[model samples]
Target: MRTFQHKVTINDMGAITIFGLGAFFCLWNRTNSLMVILGCLLIIVTIRAVDRAIHTSYVLTDDSALQIKTGRIGLTKHILLSEVKSVEKRPFAFHLGHYALIEMMNGSVVSVQPDNVDSFLSALKKRIEKKDNEV
Candidate 1:
């Protein structure tokens, strides 16, 4: 089994922080409380996103299942290799860019960006192929 921990890029955190603060300032002291609420929501969203990213981790099992876990919200997902339709590796763009997109047989998609994406993909392919041989 191989495990990878996702780290939130500094650039991403900085960008989100700046944007959230800007929104809060713009909406502050507004006549209606609705605007303030909206600003707070924005900031909350930013915090959640960053928190999730920081806590996200992946586990690749020998049986060809990839487990995604986010400690922040206690979210866990398992994607079986047999059910995966396709896997795409994307070159990193900005700080918050995702590395891989896994499409499942049920038409749903899961996105993950492990710290070492190339190695993750290589290991995943090997595990999937090994499972197929066993089957």
Candidate 2:
């Protein structure tokens, strides 16, 4: 099995910095109730980004399954090679940039943006093709 780490994009860094700074400024001058609430929100967002950076990963298993693990809620989704219909590069709906989109035979789609997207896609495609040939 191979595990691919999540890519820390410019947007991710920007969000973390912005939220961290905002939280610091808000909490530093906590004279108003609204500022405290906003500070707490900012801290939550910053922590979420950190958690995602630390925990999100893609695992390709020897049994032809791709496991997508997400942080915070610890959600995991597994996709079998035989269930994958196609793979393409497109703008991810939930993210700021492009990612590898894997479409399943049942019409579900999963997006993945690994640290080395090209290598990840090539490896996944090769596995899928090999699985196809075997069937």
CA lDDT, every model vs. true structure: 0.78, 0.88
CA-RMSD of model 1: 3.2
| lDDT measured at residue 116 in model 2 versus the true structure, 0 to 100 | 81
Q: Judging by TM-score against the true structure, name the best candidate.
A: 2
Residues 47-70, model 1: lDDT tens digits: 777777678899998767899997
Q: Estimate each model's TM-score.
A: 0.75, 0.83
> How high is the lDDT of residue 116 in model 1?
78
Model 2 lDDT, residue 9, Cα: 76
Q: Model 2, which residues run further than 4 Å from truth?
A: 91-98
Residue pairs with clashing backbones, model 2: none
Candidate 2 lDDT score at position 67: 91
